[model samples]
Target: MAEEELQLEDGSKKKKLFIIIIAVVVLLVGGGAAYYFLMGSDEAVSEEMTEQGADNDSDESLTSTTVKTGTALYVAMPRPFVFNVPGSTRDRIVEIKAQLMIRGSDNEEKAKMHVPLIEGALLRIFSTANADDLATEAGKLAIRESALKEVQIALSEITGQKVVEEVLFTGFVMQ
Candidate 1:
């Protein structure tokens, strides 16, 4: 009778232990499923937000357009001018100073129209001056300023634009 009672007690304890283990496993599986669902939704929300941000950036870039502008270029050089010297000896080396003022136009035709007058003005200066006067700094500055004014006027007439503001020394050589 005593052995029979002990066996019944041991069997009941084993049954209860198995039931507890099963309940713990089921709870763990349920928790894992819930976590996966929550993380998946978060990822989907982030992806949608990123895509919308990209679309907004593209639209903003399209709305802002760039405007094209024309540039003024430096004029070319190496043109020679000969001046008449009053007291110049045959072998005497004379210095002549001159500057060319040029303006660029948005229109090619306008630039072309001003080229002749610019060249002509420079040519006339060369025809009148001697080397001794040009050697001085003051003379050179005066010549440059005058040339610039003439070029600006000619360009204004040709291109109808503020052709030139100043003359630049394209080339300066003592010899």
Candidate 2:
């Protein structure tokens, strides 16, 4: 009986070890296959893009006529604008945190260099807003548009280009 029991235990241990080895092999093979498929596809795509680019060199002039914008960058104001606006019933204090969205590194540098001008321009626009108008969505949009225009005009005078593409209000509070 003891010898039979020892044989049975040895057989079960071998079975478990064999199963574990098979599982490990399967996982490694699956991982290798997945890596090959994913990495191979990226290389294929990059090669295709390079070939297409080479073929499109002569067509560059046709595309060049269209205005191309550069990468978008944001420049945040150093401080938020705090002001008082008169509403129908009372005067409310408002705080607006603004960022300037510009295109290209050149525009980014120009905007950073003249942040004071941009801030002043934005403050002038924000100060003109009515508290009641600011309570609605359309009023906020109107102010944003006015701010963009003012900043562009100010930047254009100094940089000879519109350094700012948009005036983004990151935060707004009314009390």
Best by lDDT: 2
Model 2 per-residue lDDT tens digits across residues 1-175: 9999999999999999999999999999999999999999999999998887666554643221122278889999999999999999999999999988777897788899999998888888888999999999999999998888888778778877767767889999999
lDDT of 1 by residue, 96-151 (tens): 34343333444334544556677776656555555565678886677676665556
lDDT of predicted model 1: 0.57
Q: All candidates: CA RMSD in angstroms?
A: 22.8, 7.7
On the 0 to 100 scale, the lDDT of residue 152 in model 1 is 56
Score every model by TM-score: 0.43, 0.62
* Candidate 2, poorest ten consecutive residues by summed lDDT: 59-68
Candidate that would win on TM-score: 2
The per-residue C-alpha lDDT of model 1 at residue 95 equals: 38
Model 2 score (lDDT): 0.84
Off by over 4 Å in 2: 1-68
